[model samples]
Target chain A: MVIKMNPYIEYGKKAFAKNLVYRSDYIIGVFNTVIMVFIQVAIWRAIYGSNTQINGVPFSYVATSFVLSICFAAALTANDFVLADKVLYGSITTELLKPISINLCIMADTIGNNLFKLIMQFAPAVIISGLFLGLLPPASVLMLLLCVFSLIFGFLIVYYISYIIQACSFWFTNVWSLSVIKNSVISILSGTLIPLWFLPDWLAAAIKWTPFDVIYFAPIQIYLGQMNTQEIIFTFAKQIVWVLLFAVLGMFIYKKGIKKLCIAGG
Target chain B: MRKLFEPFSFYFQHSKMLTKTRMQYKLDAFLCCIAVFVRESAGIVGVFLVLQTFNNIGGWNMQELFFLFSIIFLTYSFLVFLFSGIRDFSNIVNNGEFDKYLLRPRSVLLQIISANSDYFAAIGHGTLGLVLFIISANSIGTDWSFANILYLIITIIGGVLIQASIWLLFSCSSFFLIKTDSLKDFLYWNTRKFAGYPLSVFPGFIQKLLMFVIPFAFVNYFPAQYFLHKPDLAN
Candidate 1:
């Protein structure tokens, strides 16, 4: 029997294989992530001093949220900087000459890199959290299943967001500032630094209206069973919507940027 | 006397060159300034949200916390802006930049630092810290007498020196370790993380580690405690 494979899948596999050669780099990356997780846990532990629950959320749950946050944060791509460099150096012209869509190539590469990191960094982080940090178990078996699905959707949303940011490099010689602003807003609004529950009611509500929460907070909420079944379904619906919306937005920007490139005779 | 001023003049010249090059991209530099402000302000925002949720953490109120945070921010950013080159010392060693620096008439340390002076980035962080410092001082009713002002300046200088010393130590490690990025990352992340909170929050051992082992506690924790009139208390 013969089998057919997608070339994008091949590109992803190549990326994964290429990363394996840099064992020391990824090991350092993992260690950095572990320290981050530990610091976050320690901070939360200090905050919960002598109180089992604050605002109806348990300390154990918060600890678990932080562990998951570190995991997802590690599962991020270098696409924005890579794309920016390619454009800045005029290497993007060569990339454009390829038969495949540059955006699709970016998406595949990001997915490949993130998948490798998720396995290499995230797995060790989870074990470390369980042994040292007193991480809470999922609320239920069903919740664990739902959490995985939510995380996959969350990854898609995050990927599209990165793509959109990378597209901005066409206009700016340096997207460092824009990237920094995006990161700051995401860290706050995504509940990675502190859970939305700890935020003021008005501010928390405002953040909930944005897609940032779906990337990190929603998956953790699902894992902790903080929401009812109805709320869980609603969360999944929102994440899917965000992923679709951002995917369209990213493609639109890429098309316009490419059109500009043609007009410039590049 | 000529030797003493040599480093200063070299730094001034290099910084001037860097400023001219950076000014070529005015809009990008301006955007980066805004970016630095927003990125650094995230920690303050997190502290604010935490304090707003609960009146205090580890017996320190919001105003005291702000005071602690602002001082660390001011000194850390100042150090980073002036000696940002130290952060990439490993790369310099690998790329033979250090060899070139050694051949120059000026001290290598001055050249390295002046080569990487990120003035615009510093402006963003320093401005935010200054704003936070004023607000915090007002809330805490700090008396700005000559002695108090002198003391604050001394403390800030001390903090900057301590931070620079830590980075220098890390840079030295690059001479021995083939891969120093992990060590560098650990030091950088831990100090930034620990400085953002009151030292009292951590377990006793970690507190001691920060206070004596790393002495990062001096960055903000010790100064804030002294000013807040908690000299008798030890976490």
Candidate 2:
């Protein structure tokens, strides 16, 4: 039997290819990410001066976690600005009439764009940090494979969160600051700026229950061998559950948003 | 005197109109303020987490670091509030609205900067910074002498000037590229992320780069150090 491919993945590929045309634009983006990562690593290094551990995780592990978190964030924060614009200016009307589901198309395109960014921006960043600043290697081959899957889950979690923010444009009409709030909250809660281990115990535990930790913290934990096999599976299960939940929530929001837009003649 | 007064009066008038427009969309304006506040608070939380982990980064404790962070944060909030038009310069230039500013009788720079003063977002960020400032000051037992106050005021104004010039330089590139928003975002926004931390945590070369090339060191690092009476490390 022949296998049928998802058409939305084709949109992802087209979106990926679209970015290749502007590959030059991302050179500075990679450079900026590298510099930012370097600055972060340096701060962590200073914090760990003459010391080996930060809240049970070694300094090196924490640095590696930061590297992964920063790169993942750079790669996965897909273009909500464009989505917001489409909603704001009534261009979403035509977008809704597309052959495939609008949300699927947008997510596919975002995934493609983020895939390109992962290769261009995130790959170089990891390489630079690995060479110069000492990014830690994945624990084992199995952990490496699991880490990659977790990163995909992480991306989906972020994508859903961003989708909700974009969908807010229907209700709020001018939800630009909502994006800023979303990003900042993600950066903190997802362990982009600081590892979950460093957060206050109660706060860390609280964040673990949210989808934010599944985005960066869980993968970083797996990469650092902080989680056992069963723990890794459980973490992955949690991420998958969050992804499904957010995906459903996103679709519901989109449906209601579209209805509101139609009724309001936006 | 009249020439100088004209710009201030124009800014005041434009700001009033902008505030009124913002009030028209009361819910959005309120939500935007809360959003900005949340973003700023998250940055503080990041700082709090890091300092909690390390106890002190370089020679600076959490209170001292918060002071440094607040200075940059408050100044940035002020810049965003007063000169939001400059931040949106690329949009204006790209959409041909810049031609309108150019055609105005007033100073083109003044007219451009006064176009969209984002008072609500500014207040949100600024209030966060002010709150942090008060917290840090109280925690550190900061000397509230007249001299210290004068120095703090001057240094803060200088920091604001540095930030404004950075924005102006990057935004001015829109004239040549006509699509400089991405570049501006990269340069202006990304670089500012490093401002909250102590410069001493960075390598010597990065320290030199921040001090000389970008002048971000002046934004908070050097000023906070001087304000706190720490020995100069730049020299």
Candidate 3:
């Protein structure tokens, strides 16, 4: 019997295998996550000194939020430079010539890297931090399932956003700055650095309109049971909408960028 | 003394050429500066937002917190500008560039340290640090006496050395290990993030760890206390 793997999957597998070669990186990645989790928890503990909750949110809730947010952030490591590097080195022309979809190949490669991170980095970090920091149980098994579903959507949202940014490489000399700015914006608005609950009411309200929150905060809310059933459904809808919006925008820019792309040499 | 000064002269020439090359891409250089500025400011914003909601953390007010962070940013600017070569030493080693340096006449450390500099990070972090310093220095009511100014300058220099030494130590591991980037991230980057806030807020063990194991507390927390005189300084 002959079983042929999809080319996209093969690319993804290659990326996954590439990451595994760096053994020390995986070990240190887990420690990095643990330290980050500890720092966040420590800072929160400082803020919550002698008080059980602030603004109606419990200390445990904040702790749980950090654990989930940090782990998800670690696992959501989509290679923002995958396409940018190809475009820069003029290899993208050869990529285009291949019968396989370049977009799928990028996505598959990112998924492969992310899958490795999820297993190697995210799982261990979450377990260690969850044990050390004491994560709150999910609101329900149903909520847990929904959180997982929402997280997949969040990953897609992040991937598409990075894709949109990298697509600008065709016009720009490099997308490094664009990617950095995108990361800063996402980190702040997505509740990865600090939960939106701590933000001023006006700022929090404004952030609600952006796609950033759907990336991390929405899923945390789903798991924490901070949202009611109506709100959960609404948040899921927002995540899906943002994913679709970004995917379409990314494709549109990619098409425009392909037209603008001019390789000087082989 | 002349022999000692030779590497310094060489470093200046190397960095000068590197700067000129980088300046040719004016827009990219400008955007890189803005990118680092914005990226760093996000953490400051997080701290600001948190302080706004809570009013204070572990006896440190917003102004004191900003002062602490300013120290970190300022010292880090200098550290990255001068020691980026050390920070990226493992890459040089992996790329087999270190072997070329070993064959050179000048000191290997000097050649490595003078090889590259990140002017963009220096500009970006320097600007943000200076902005934060001016704002916090004015509002924090620190008596800017001559001695206090001297202490600030000395502490910043000390902070940069302490941080650079840490980088050097981690990069040295590359000789024995295949990769040390993750270890550097775990030890240096992650520890530095913790140093952005007051060390007093952490648990007793974390405070001890930061003080003894990492010594990051001296980078900002303790020096800021010299001016702010926070209650937790005794601990």
Best model per TM-score: 3
**lDDT digits (tens) for residues A3-61 of candidate 3:** 34588789999989999998887888888888888889988888888999889999998
Better of 1 and 3 by lDDT: 3
Q: What is the TM-score of chain B in candidate 3?
A: 0.95
Which residue ranges in model 2 land beyond 4 Å of their true spot? A1-7, A81-83, A262-266, B1-4, B232-235
Q: Cα miss at B120, model 2 (Å)?
A: 2.0
Each model's C-alpha lDDT? Answer: 0.80, 0.81, 0.88
TM-score ranking of the models? 3, 1, 2
Model 3, position B180, has a per-residue lDDT of 76
Q: Better model by DockQ, 1 or 3?
A: 3
lDDT of 3 by residue, B169-229 (tens): 8888899885777777777788877688988778788888889888999889888888887
Which pairs in model 3 have colliding backbones?
none
Ranking by lDDT: 3, 2, 1
Best by lDDT: 3
What are the candidates' individual DockQ scores? 0.71, 0.71, 0.80
Q: After superposition, how far is residue B104 of candidate 2 from its true place, in Å?
A: 2.9
RMSD to the hidden true structure, all candidates: 2.7, 2.6, 2.5
